[model samples]
Target chain A: AQSVTQPDIHITVSEGASLELRCNYSYGATPYLFWYVQSPGQGLQLLLKYFSGDTLVQGIKGFEAEFKRSQSSFNLRKPSVHWSDAAEYFCAVGKGNQGGKLIFGQGTELSVKP
Target chain B: DTAVSQTPKYLVTQMGNDKSIKCEQNLGHDTMYWYKQDSKKFLKIMFSYNNKELIINETVPNRFSPKSPDKAHLNLHINSLELGDSAVYFCASMGAGRGEQYFGPGTRLTVT
Candidate 1:
């Protein structure tokens, strides 16, 4: 079955440290990939997305994601994490012909340690 | 200026009661969508409207209905709300193409 998987349920990283959140999608062909972040008492914000072209994509909030077709993985990375970066991260997959429906993974919650 | 906005950010009501959540986008997007985030925080697409036309309807309860008054607005109505209906409902929109969707602050529905 087609699905999006987020392995880590919770991750803790010290402030100013590097961060990486893993996301994997199971599908036949490459689907439109996206990463969203949701903070407490806030809406889900689009972090970045990979449609085509270059595998490496930069997003807002100093975040970046790499789309690997062979691995079917689109992992989010940040070289230097900030305390304000603590939030719930989600990985979503969209198929254009599916009428804009998105399949999202069980989000991963990030905790920044002071 | 707000791109996408949802009214009644927090809703508390009893089961069997009916409620409606309104969403509007000032971005002039042609597509609008409704998504449900369950207790587990798993986001799932419930319904979508493209130019006032229903495009995607997932496996949702019949009690849940989505009405698109125009391209800029989409409202969700739930009849006979149940305890399981207690979840966050989010509204989102996209431009002409199916690219990144801008999301609105979710509505936290609490059914007692």
Candidate 2:
């Protein structure tokens, strides 16, 4: 079974600081990975996705993630995070050509302090 | 215009009552999906439809049924609801063979 693991349940960071959200996955083969953000009472918005080539993938809201096969990790990063970036982040894994059925992680809640 | 929308943003109903949540998308996507987020914020896929055809059906109980009248609309109906059924349900749509999904604002169901 394909599964996603987001180690952090809650993280607090000062405004304008660098942010890194860790994500790891376990799958039999190379999996399609994605990161999504959700605000209270709102639907999830895609942050970024990793399909193939170019291990470093850039996404909306100035976020980027690097897919590392050796580490089995795809961690989301942003050089500077604004207070508005505080939200729940989810890491998901899916099989290629499988109609995009995603297996999501428990999610990590980010808290930004001004 | 909302890319994906779900009706009845908030639903408060008594136990044993039946209810339905409707979803619509205007993105011209060929596939639609339903997901449930529990109290702990763990999301689980419930059902999926592609072009009004059932594609993926999770381990959800038979009390829950999904209907897709057309490619752009998918509705979820629950019968004899229980307190355990209370959760936030989301509707999402994506293009065929594409991983990008557009999600609806979700409906929070509360069972009393």
Candidate 3:
């Protein structure tokens, strides 16, 4: 079974501070990894994804994630956080083909303090 | 225009009643999916339709049915809804090349 784990339940960070949300997955193969952000009452928006090639991938809103196969992790990072980035972040794993169901982790809520 | 969309942004109904939620994708994607997000924001996949074919159906209850009329539309119908079904339902579509999925605004279902 392919599953994802996001350890932090909630994280508070200061604005303009670096942010990193850790994610780990267990799968049979080199799984397809993704990060998604969801605001209150809004649906999820893709932050980034890792399939093949480079270990690091950039996404919208100046977010990026690095895929570390040895650690079985794909952690999301942002050099400087903003208040707008205060939302719930989810880590997901796919079956690695073009179209497969994605299993999401328990989300981590992010709060930014000015 | 919205890439993916769902109808009845808000649905309030009594327990034991039946309801249907419709989803559409104009991005010419071949795959569509349905996910449920609980009050605590725990998300899980319910069903997936690829090219109008039922591809993945998780351990969803038989009362929850999904219909795909075409490659661009996927609808979910829940029968005899329970209070636990009160959550936000999202519709998503994934293109062939793009590993990312685009989600709709979501339909909030309230079963009272």
Candidate 4:
């Protein structure tokens, strides 16, 4: 069975501080990884994705993720957190083939302090 | 322009009622999906449609049905909804066999 694990349930960071959200996956082969963000009462927005080739990928809103094959993890990071960055973040894994269903992790709620 | 959109951003209904949530994507993608986010905030895939064909159907209850009129639209219908059905539903689309999925603003369904 394939699954995703986001270790942190909730994380708080100061508005100008750096942030990191950890994610790990269980899969037999190389898996496509993604990070999505959701605002309160809104649908998810794709932050970034890692299919192959590059281990590090940059995304919108100044977000980035690094896929570590050895650890089966794809962690999301931001150099400087903003007030609007306070939202829920989800990590997902999908098979490399076409038409693969996404298995999502329990999201991490981010709280930015002033 | 919104890549994907779902109607009725909020829905509140009584138990045992039947309701439908419609989704449309203007991105000309070949695949669309429906996901359910439970109270615990666990997002799970319920259905996936590719080129109007059912590609992925997660072990969802039979009371839930997904209908795709075309490659661009996928609608979910729930019959005899139960209290456990209260959750936010999201519609997403992507190019076939791709990992990047564009999600629509979810529809929060509250079954009282």
Candidate 5:
């Protein structure tokens, strides 16, 4: 069975501080990893994805993620956190060639303090 | 222009009532999906349709059925709605051979 785990349930960071959200996935074959962010009462917005290219991938809203196959982890990082960055972040593993089915993590809630 | 869109942004209904949530994608994607987000914000895939054909169906109850009249529209119909059905439902579309998915504004369904 495939699963995604986001270790941090809730994290608070000061504005302008560096942030990192941890994610780990379990899959049998080559993994397609993704990072998504959701604001309050809003649908998810894609942040970044790692299919089969570079280990580090950039995404919208000044977010980036690195896929570490050895560790089975895909963690999201931001150099400077903004108040607007306070939201829920999810890590997902895509089942390639399987109708695009995604197994999502439990999600980590980030809160920014000014 | 919205890439993917869902109707009835908010729905409040009594238990046992049947309701439908409609979804349409203008991106001309061949794959559409429905995801349920619980109050705790845990997201799960419920169903997926590829080119109007059922391709992925999770362990959802039989009361929930998905209908795709065309390649661009996928509608979810729930029968005998239970209080546990209260959650945010999201519609998403993905282009063929693309790993990225576009999501619509979710429909918050409140079953009383």
Candidate 6:
């Protein structure tokens, strides 16, 4: 079965520090990868996705993710973390022909310190 | 404007009661889905509909039924709600071939 794993359960970083959230997926074929962020009591917002070409994909709110096929990983990163960036991040994997069916990771909670 | 919207942002209900959550998308997407987030914040796909046809149905209980009146609307009806059913339910929509989905503000269901 296809699955996604987010190793870090919770991470804390300073407001101005850089951030990297790790993600790994298990799928037979080349998969569609996505990153999403959810604030407390709020719905998820799509940060970025990797489907076909570009390994490095940029998304909303200055978020970027790099998809590495060799490691079966898609890691989200930010140059500078803001206080408002504190949220739960999820990594998901989807099959090529599967319609909107996504297997999501457990989620990583980010806490930004001042 | 909201791309995808769900009704009853918060719902507190007693066990054994039946309730329904409605979802609609204005993005004209042909595919819609329902996901459940547990108290631990683990997300899982429950059901999916494409062009008003059921495409994917996970290992959800039979008490939970999904209805898609049209391509733009999908509703989930739960019968005999149990305490274990307390979780946040999210609605999402996607284009025909695109894997990217637009999510709605989730409905937090608390079964007391």
Candidate 2 lDDT score at position B90: 97
In angstroms, the error of model 4 at B17 is 0.9
Compose the digit string of candidate 4's lDDT tens values, residues A6-79.
99999999999999999999987888899999999888988999988989999999999999988999999999
Instruction: Please provide TM-scores, in order, for all candidate models, with all chains considered together.
Output: 0.98, 0.98, 0.97, 0.97, 0.98, 0.98
In the range B1-112, model 1's lDDT, one tens digit per residue, is 9999999899999999999999999998999999999988989899999999999899899999999999999999999999999999999998887678999999999999
Off by over 4 Å in 6: none
Candidate 2 local lDDT, B1-112, one digit each (tens): 9999999999999999999999999999999999999999999899989899998899899999999999999999999999999999999998977877888999999999
lDDT (Cα, 0-100) at B15 in candidate 1:
97
**On a 0 to 100 scale, what is the lDDT of residue A12 in model 1?**
100
Error of 2 at A97 (Å): 3.1
* Docking band of candidate 4: high
* Candidate 4 TM-score restricted to chain A: 0.96
For each candidate, the alpha-carbon lDDT, in order, equals 0.95, 0.94, 0.93, 0.93, 0.94, 0.95
Clashing pairs in 6: none
Q: Supply DockQ values for each candidate.
A: 0.83, 0.68, 0.73, 0.81, 0.82, 0.83
List, residue by residue over A10-101, the lDDT tens digit for candidate 3: 99999999999999999989988999999988889989888899999999999999999999999999999999999999999986372578
* Model 1 lDDT per residue over A42-74, tens place: 999999999999999999999999999888999
Q: Candidate 4, which segments miss by more than 4 Å at Cα?
A: A96-98
Task: Work out the iRMS of candidate 1.
Answer: 0.9
Residue A88 error for model 2, in Å? 0.2
The global Cα lDDT (0 to 1) of model 3 is 0.93
lDDT score for residue B59 of model 4:
92
- Sliding window of 10 residues with minimal summed lDDT for model 5 chain A: A94-103
Candidate 1 chain A least-lDDT 10 residues: A93-102
Candidate 5: the clashing residue pairs are none
Q: Which pairs clash (backbone N, Cα, C closer than 3 Å) in model 1? A: none
